[model samples]
Target: MKHLRFLNKYFYKYKWWIIPGVFFVIISNIFGVIPAQVIGHAFNLITENIQIYGLFSGFERREIIYDIFSYSLLYFGALVLVLYLLRGLFLFFMRQTIILMSRHIEYDMKNEIYAHYQELSLGFYRRNNTGDLMNRATEDVNRVRMYVGPAIMYAINTGVLFLLVIYAMFSVNTTLAIFCLLPLPVLVVIIYFVNTMINQKSEQIQEQLSKLSSFVQERFSGIRVIKSYVREPYTKKVFAEESEGYKQSAMSLVKVQALFYPTMLLLVGLSTILTIYVGGKQVINGSITPGNIAEFIVYVNQLTFPVSMLGWVTTLIQRASASQKRINEFLQLKPEIISGKQEKRAINGNIKFENVSFTYPDTGIKALRNVNFEIKQGQFVAIIGRTGSGKSTLANLIMRMYDVEAGRIIIDNTYLKELNLQDYRNQIGFVPQEVFLFSDTIKNNIAFGLDTVNDNEVEAAAKNAAVYNNIIDFELKFETMLGERGITLSGGQKQRVSIARALIKEPKILIFDDCLSAVDTRTEEEILNNLGRIMNNKTSILIAHRISTIKNADKILVLDDGQIIEEGTHNELLQKGGAYAEMYQNQLLEEESQSV
Candidate 1:
């Protein structure tokens, strides 16, 4: 129930419409109750031969019939008209308010969740599944809407209707009314047990459904690889198994629902029998009149109708409860990294790693161990290492993707954790190993970071990344649509476009995490040369596997097993005959052999 507290503000916000809706609901129900009373009164007047002596002493019997019939017709017409109008008004405002509230809540929830994702350390995403996150954002929010809108309104209506019917029954005969309500406690017990089961089963069904969706999404995204490897049949089998699990869970819920309605109907049928039998005996004994018995029957039926709807309403609430729990779990997750408490000043690109050590959350292995390094305001440094040698981990640390367990990272003489996260990240530009671009224009991609960059700046960045010529050759030039994840472009072209995106930011520190690995050596050299010409007096860190990529850097560090084994300029490392020299010689040998 606490999980549903997020909806309180929205419900209160729309109280203007809800208050009027409640008023109309009450008016409609009041009119609805009139028909039963009117019919009962008319039946008694005709059966007992009651005369209108006070109103018209001279009127004949035919005139009396005409007058009673006319009044009855008028009352019926007025009752119908009022009920119809009130119902229309209630529904109109209810729908408008519910839809608007759902939209606002969905929008706020998505934005808050997305913002939290951005603030979380990289380790959180690594541990969670992409499909699960999608489920939380889309399916879970919809469940909240169900509870807030239709479920709430129906519950209110049921309570009001039940109370009004009970009061009407008591006015007719209190003893008979008490006997008719005997099955209510039993019905309540059954509903409570069913609601518990429904909540549990609903959770299982939702979880299985998420797995099915995830399996389909992952298979479609990786279809190219699957086809190349001739594993389509195997993939299909896996998907079928996941789909079967979802089916079984859904069937379990169906079985419970199958029992729910019939059980409610049985209880209602028994209650109706008791009302008819007891009321019939009372009328025979002349303890109550036939007109009173007729009205009591109508009220009893009214009570049963709302009681039956309570079962369906309970089922909806159970489903919503399950979904609320899932959504609450996601919202409750605290990010590993915390943003600054105070405002941050501008950065000056001085980076220092003071004996920092880090271990990824939920894993015991150390990624960086007692590492120390420093870079001044303006220098080009390259970090060269083998796979799993912690080069990318070093880059991630400087960007504050994950905080260090021991020691501090300082930028411009201030600890990284003490600075505002959004402000700190704004000062650094990064091109990741895997490039991701939205399905938008090339010009928009290049100008992504800057809110007010001109076309000239976009062109300059593209030219520096050596991708401007390619864009010009396109049919729509920079305005051309790239398709999903930039699927329309070649691998090298995508990397260059991503590079252009990072370069457009004009940050004080630039980091490239093997972004040029896909391009041919000649094209790579051209982009590197362009970068060197434009990156005047700015700190740059390049992570690359090829020796040629980083040979001209002011300093280079060779890493292995999370430790820096060699640190020097390219010429000095070659002279030392250490690990860096060995790697360089091996690369040279491989190239010579390929040429031969």
Candidate 2:
């Protein structure tokens, strides 16, 4: 009951529907027991008027007995018929209203989970896998729905029917009724223990499912790498092992159910035996009529189904309990990144990193050490750093992907933390080295950042990125749908499209974090040449390894081992004979060698 406390709000939300549904459940079950009582009375009526159906038509017959038997049989038939009608009607409403409400609640829960996921910081995504999250949203949500819908409905049905049948049994013969109900407490104890085991097993099974889902998702996403390495046999073996673990968990649950249901059935069967023996003796001893024995038997038989159903309903409840616990654990997590309450104001893109030092979560290594730099509005600054020298980390900080651990990042003379996060991010455009595109039309992908797509703006952005000519060469042009992550396009084409996506935003500050690495030097130069006009009067930060890409920028900062080693123009760095000069020489030599 405590585990189900999370669903209190949903129950309150749908109480109008749920209350009527529960009412129907009670009505249906109440009607359900009427048939058994009617059958018993019909038997008693026949017994009372045994001579009414005499063999000879001319035999002396009691007219009143004949009329009473005929009328009683007709009335009993009509009573049973009407009860069936009411039972069916209420059952329909119970299932239609309650089960559908559960589905609606499921929809709301999934949406809520997804909405919360969007609000969580990037660090959370780094710690969790997509498949595990998917399992919680889909399979776990479905299990919760079972608890809210069928398990609740059936539990109520069992309770109502049990009470009605018990009263009916006592009315037939109190002693027999008491004796027949003696085994129910033992059945309850058995159910409680079995339910505990089932819950533990269900948790294990759900965990295994998450692992298997993660494995399949990761493998499929990297199938090309696996195929290129010819590792299918090894991957298949790993999948088979995971599948076996899942099967073992499932079998454990099945084994518990296999034992539990039969035990319940056996107890119910014993209760029926008790009723037959006790009632038969009472009849034989003249303490009750033969009709009383028949009626008691019918009442005890009606008790069998609800008693046996206890095990199944218990399984639903425990499974839902286990799933709800998992979901609540995720829901309880509060995001580390909190947005500011300030309203968005105009930004001039005067960015400054003042003595910034940062370290990643769960790692002792400082990714950036007292990094100090500033770019005035409309300044073109290039950061050239070796691999692992914290260039991307700087861009990520500026994007507000992670906060600096020890220092302040100021934008437009205000601390970055004080600005509204969404509004701040909306003013900046970013293109990362690894590009990802949705499976949508080329036009839609380019215009994805905009609230509304303007065809003219999209085409201009594509042209500025130098991918427009190649796009128009296709038969469908901008309307063509891309494959997953734009796999159908070449590497350079994909990067250009990503650039176009950023350019369409017309952001005040544009950070290109080695996004042109895949393009050839010629196309890279052409795209940069076109960007000169678009970048006018706007601040731009170019992070790259190629000296040619940033040689013409207003300023260049060379980084090494998380510290800036050189800061000057291209010719100034060459004259100083520092790290940038050496890198330029090596790159020139590599190019000269490649030509030969």
Highest lDDT among the candidates is held by which one? 2
Summarize candidate 2's per-residue lDDT along 552-586 as a digit string, tens digits.
99889999888888898999999999899999999
Kindly report which residue stretches of model 2 are placed more than 4 angstroms away from their true locations once superposed.
Answer: 51-71, 285-288
Candidates in order have lDDT scores of: 0.81, 0.88
Show the lowest summed lDDT stretch of 10 residues, model 2. Answer: 51-60
Q: Please give me the total number of clashing residue pairs in predicted model 1.
A: 0
TM-score of each: 0.93, 0.96
Best by TM-score: 2
Model 1, 1-596: lDDT tens digits are: 66677667767877775676566556556655655675566556555644453445565765776677678667755765676576667656656665565567678777877776766678877887788878877887777667776777677777777777778778878877887888889988998898889888888988997887777877787787999999999998998889888888889988988998888778878877887889789888887777776677776676666777787778777777788788778677888888876586778788998988888777777888888888887788999989988888899999988889898999888888888988888878899988999989999988887788898999999988989999999999999999878988999999999999989998889999999988898888888888887678888899999999999998898888888888889999999999999999999999999999
